[model samples]
Every structure is written in C-alpha cells, then in structure tokens.
Target: MHEFSIAQALVEQIEAAATKEHAKRVVRVVITVGALSGVDPEALRSLFPLVAEDTVTADAELVVEPVSARVRCRACGREEAAETSFLRCSVCGSRDVELIAGRELHIKTVELEIDER
Candidate 1:
C-alpha cells in the first residue's frame, strides 16, 4: 500500500536526521497528519516498524497528531471545521470557501538518543 512507501520515506528522513545529530538511536517521532491528507494513520503506524527495521528508528515511537479539516467561508466570514465529503461553508451554506487547514503530513519533531562515548 501507499502507507508502506510513505513509512519508508519517513524512516529514511528520520534516520538521516538522527545520523546528523550523531544519535545512538531514535526515541520518538512526532508527526502532524491532516484529515484531508488522504493518509491512514493506522496503516502508516502498522507499517512504520517494517520500514524502519534495522534503522535508528526501529524502536522509535510514532506519535501522530491529527488535524481536522477546516475552511473559511468567504460569504459569511466564518471559519469552522469542514465536512470531509463536502467543502461547503457551514454558516452561509456556500460552496465558495477556502481551505485553511487539513492536507498536511509532516514531521513535527524527532527525539533522539545521543551517545557521548
């Protein structure tokens, strides 16, 4: 699935960062995921270990912060969470809305274990 590929890329990035920091291992990885990003967090979670196998992030914890889809209504000047299936303004019921959030998938932080020895 696409999750496997995504997880692979994520592990690669984490590994690179950890190596750059001279980390002994990775402790945790925090990522932000949006509802409209078309990514299944559970699937990604399940496949992360497989992709991170033998890497610094092998035992790292993956924390996914979920972000709800939000939109701003141009007609009513209101901002609120938008329905995933329909992108309409909740207040004015107008289709003329601008997406303010949701559609994000990025690494927020990475905790690492560095060795002085």
Candidate 2:
C-alpha cells in the first residue's frame, strides 16, 4: 500500500522538525486528510508506527483529522459538499463547479517534548 510511502515521508518530516527544534521526543503529530485525498486512514495509521520505529516520532501519537469535500457552483454561486469523482454542486445540480476543499494531505503540527536539564 502507498500508506507506507506516506508514512515514511511523515517520519522523515517529523525527524527533521524534532532535530531542528532540539526536541527529546515527539508527543504527537496532527495531520489533516481530506475526503478526496484518497488516503486510507486505517492503512496510514498502521504504517505510521512501523515507519516511525527508533525515530524521534516512535512514541508520538498520530492524529488524523478528516476534512469534508466542498465545492462551489460557478453558475449558481452555491456551495455544498461534493462527491469524490463528479464534484457536482448539490444545490444547483451543476457540473461547472470548482472544488473548494477536500483534496489535502499535510501535517499541521508536531508536538514535541523538550529535555529538562
């Protein structure tokens, strides 16, 4: 599954950030995943723990926030939830709609612990 690759990337990012901030360990990683992002949340979570082995993020909790699919109709100026493939506006039933959200996959925040000397 591609979740392995995504998990690897997440670990790399977390390691870099933790090193830059001089963190002793990572506590949590908050990520935002859109409904249309095509990522399997269960699979992603399963891969994260494995990929984070022995890293600063090994003990970190992965928090995944799901974003809803939104679209705006060009003709009716209406905005509503959208389907994955069609992305049609529900209010106006128009196909000439622009996607407003639900296509994102990014790490929002990384909570880390600092060594207390």
Candidate 3:
C-alpha cells in the first residue's frame, strides 16, 4: 500500500535528521495529517514500526494529529467545517467555497534522545 512507501520515506527522513543531530534514538515524531490529504492515519501508523525497524526511529513513538477541512464562503463571508464529500458554503449554499485548511501532511516536531556519556 502507499502507507508503506510513506512510512519508508518518513523513516528515512527521521534517520537522516537523527544522524545529523547525533541523537542516540528518536523518542517521538509528531505529525499533522489533514483530512483532505487522502492518507489513512491508522494504516500509516501500522506501517511505521515495520519501516522504522533497525533505523534511528526504530523505537520512536508516532503521534498523528488529524486536521479537519475548513471552508470559507466568498458569497456570504462565512467560514465553517466542510463535509468530506461535498464542500458547500453553509451560509450562502454556494458550492464555490475556498478551502482554508486540510490537505497537508507534515512532521510537526521530533523528540530525540542524546547521550552525554
């Protein structure tokens, strides 16, 4: 599945960062996933350990934060949560609405473990 590939890429990036920072291990990875990003968070989380095994993020915890879609109506100057299937302006009932949020997948923070010894 695409989740496996995504996990592979995440592990690679985490590993590279850990190496660069001279971290003994990665403690946690905080990621923000938008609802419109078309990513299955559960599937991605399941694939993480498999891909991260033997890597710098092997034991790292993966924290996924879900983001909801927000739409802004130009006709009524109103903003509200948009339905996943149909995004229409709640106030004006217009289908022409600008997506304000959702459709993003990014790593927000990385916690690392460093060894002084």
Candidate 4:
C-alpha cells in the first residue's frame, strides 16, 4: 500500500525535525488527517512502525486527529459540514463554494524529550 511510503516520509520528516531540535528521543507525533486528504488513517498507523525501524521515531506515539469535511458557501456565506467529493451549499444549494477544511494533512505537534547527557 502507499501508506508505507507515506509513513516512511513521515518518519523521515520527524527524524529531521527531532534532530534539528536536538532531541534525545521522539516521544510523540500528532497529526491532523483530513477527511478529503485521501490518506487512510488506519493504514498509515499500521504501516508506521515498519518504516520507522532504526529511526528516532521508531517508538514515537503516532496520534491521528481526524478533521471532518467542511465547506464555505459563496452564495449564502455559510460554513457547513460536507461529504467528501460533494461541494454544495446545504442552505442555498449553490455549487459555488470554497473549501475551508477537510483537505489537509498537517503535522500538528511533535513531543520530544531531551536528555541531559
């Protein structure tokens, strides 16, 4: 699955960040997974460890925070939850809409531990 590649990339990114911060160990990596990001959270979670072997992120806790789909209607100026692949205003039934959320995959936080060595 492509989740392995994604996980590998994620671990590499975490390692880079941890190294830049001079961290002794990476304790946690919190990520926000959007509904429309097309990345399966469960698959990513299962594949993370495989790609993290021998890395600073090997034992880091991977916390996935899901973001629900949402859109902003241009006609009605209303923001509401939406289904994936459907961008319509529930109130005004307008096809003209702007995506406000649910299409992003962002690393929210990285919890690191520094050892006084």
Cα-based TM-score, every candidate: 0.94, 0.93, 0.93, 0.92
Clashes (backbone N, CA, C under 3 Å), per candidate, total 0, 0, 0, 0
Clashing pairs in 1: none
**lDDT of candidate 1 over 5-66, digit per residue (tens):** 89988998999899899998999999999999989999999999988889889999999999
Model 3 TM-score, all chains together: 0.93
Whole-model lDDT, model 1: 0.93
State each model's CA lDDT, in order.
0.93, 0.91, 0.91, 0.90
Kindly list the per-residue Cα lDDT of model 3 for residues 1-117, writing each as its tens digit: 788888888888888889988999999999999999889999999999998998879899999999999999988889999987899997789998999989988988899998886
Report the number of the highest-TM-score candidate: 1
Q: Can you write out model 2's per-residue Cα lDDT over 23-97, one digit (the tens) per residue?
A: 999999999999988899889999899999988898899999998899989999998887777788777688999
Model 2 CA deviation exceeding 4 Å by range: none
Task: Write the residue-wise lDDT of candidate 4 on 58-86 in tens digits.
Answer: 89899999998899999989999998878
Determine which window of 10 residues in candidate 4 has minimal summed lDDT: 1-10
lDDT of 1 at 110: 99
Write the number of the candidate with greater lDDT, choosing between 1 and 2.
Answer: 1
- Taking every candidate in turn, the Cα RMSD to the unseen true structure, in Å, is 1.2, 1.3, 1.3, 1.3
The residue pairs found clashing in candidate 3 are none
Q: In terms of TM-score, how similar is model 1 to the real structure?
A: 0.94
